[model samples]
Target: MGLAAASSEHAPVAACGFAEATAVLRRLTADDLERVNETILDRMRSRAPMIPELAGHLLRAGGKRIRPMLTLAAARLFGYRGLEHVKLAAAVELIHGATLLHDDVVDGSALRRGAQTANVIWGNKESVLVGDYIFSRAFELMVSAGDLKVLQILSAASGVIAEGEVLQLSTQNNLDATFEMYLAVIEAKTAALFAAAAEAGAVIAGCSEEDAEALRRYGADLGVAYQLVDDALDYSGAEDALGKRVGDDFREGKMTLPVVLALARAEGEETAFWRRVIAEGRQDADDFDRARAIMRRAGAIEDTIGCARRYAETALASLQDVRGAKDEACLRALADLAAASTRRSN
Candidate 1:
């Protein structure tokens, strides 16, 4: 869900084979990314002065930039050498950041990446407006590229993501949620953007329609795998390690994979506890420890990890059709990174 560190430096070396791929893309796509960054800054500056300043504050926070990196990697792997990939990559990041700005408001979150959330510092109205501003600016950049297909892909993804968020909201604490329903929600909310990122890259590279389909699958599988690992970490990781409080999902009444699976397999009083307390959002002071123990007993954490691994495997398998290139290897490495993200104890 966020960046992390491993104890031995070797672990990152091992975990971030995909990260190395991005570095390679950085060298290959540096000029384009630079231009895109400059254009973004200039476009934001054209907004009323303070709006750009506030939005820019969040942009400068320096995230992993993985979405753009995936775009660049896809283009390079498909043997594309053009400026449009850079614009699409920026578009990807802008869309992602816009969602985060809104998500902080929806979740009532106070912090992100160890800094105060824009909504926390600036208020919900300002955060939402700035997020919309970024969304419009991203489209303006995309329009400059003159790629109708790119526009369609991103626009569709935006709609799917919104639907996913609302689906989750409607499903909150509804313990009857099935794994199929969960997958549907995640595919829309999380995987659709990944599909767009890869599809946009292939479009920029002038790939065949079939190859474009493959890239989309790659992104979708990776997206599903990434989110599963994030959910697992909520149970397996410590508060400091997770960069948020442990059991925060429980407190929020948000039912995740672990909770769903655990409830299905729970026994006797364990089942009653979840039904009455965790799902009902009515836990007494004494329920937390017992509920946690019940979850551990149900093998919820193991089930989540197993499901994430399956998606990682699916992601790697989707790369089989692509010809081997620097970008292809990087894509495989990205798959490895997706697998590794699920494997992490942090």
Candidate 2:
């Protein structure tokens, strides 16, 4: 189906985006998520003297907590009642936090969730150390589950994530970044953690290898869709709604999909405009407007959205092997939710 048709057909079935995610997530109670979150926070707080303060600063900022929720919800859907789910959820959240700390430093981000970033409040050295503290605490918390498989899975994903970040940095201004390269970087940098989250849920729940693998695929595809839309929104999203400065990637000389497509279609002055923006990193408000116009003229936004829809479809298809009746429905809804979220304002 085309984008409009897909949106219309899936609207009722998927519950749009946040509504669907909220409904599926409701399977796990607030107390359940909060209990796990508190434990995670407490463990971080209990860390040795000065490090706790640094870690505490970022933790207090608070986020949507979507990663851990994915893990907890998957475990609950599979009938897992053990406390291990709590630890695993905390582990995912901590891992996520560590990445953000590092990302803020790399991106020179001053604010996050309407608060000063650790790097901005504290020094980069302190932010990096506190990030390490969270990583260590996450591993320590993981030991309570006693699953070496989970540890190995998370470890490998973490390595790939770091490598992907470096790769993205390397390709920052090189407008020649291929579509394949873009997908690979996203899978490693962003999707790997999502894959680990869902796979760990199944592992802790004693799910079969097949079912666990299926969930892993689901998370990976969902993450791809999530990040693709994120990059797309950087061009079109309102600054206030995005919760970050707009056109940041372009200003940073980062060549995202929108810019890539615009470059490919550019001719004459348009091509030189892209070169100045991407190569020189010279951008202003009018530059952002012109870039958006260029992207629209080149059909990059629509193309990128189409790719996101494909990933969402793949995510939905991956659930075919899952056995439970609700599992399939919820997973399908989750896929639709992912797809619908691409067009969201926030």
lDDT of 2 by residue, 1-346 (tens): 1223323454544546654565556454466688776887688765366676767777666666767877876676566778888888888888888988999899898867667788988879888888888888888888877889988878888899989899899778787787778888899898999889888987787777887898899889988987888889888888877777777787887777777777888977998898788887777669988998888888998888888878877876666556542344445444555556565665
The lowest-lDDT stretch of 10 consecutive residues in candidate 2 is 1-10
Q: Considering every candidate listed, which one attains the maximal lDDT? A: 2
What TM-score should be assigned to candidate 1? 0.86
Per-candidate RMSD, Å: 5.6, 4.0
Work out the TM-score per prediction.
0.86, 0.90
| Index of the highest-TM-score prediction | 2
Per-residue alpha-carbon lDDT of candidate 1 for residues 183-280, written as tens digits (9 for 90 to 100): 88888888899889888988778877877787788889888987787777776777765665666667666678988898899887777777886568
lDDT of 1 at 293: 78
Candidate 1 local Cα displacement, residue 284, angstroms:
5.3
lDDT of each: 0.74, 0.77
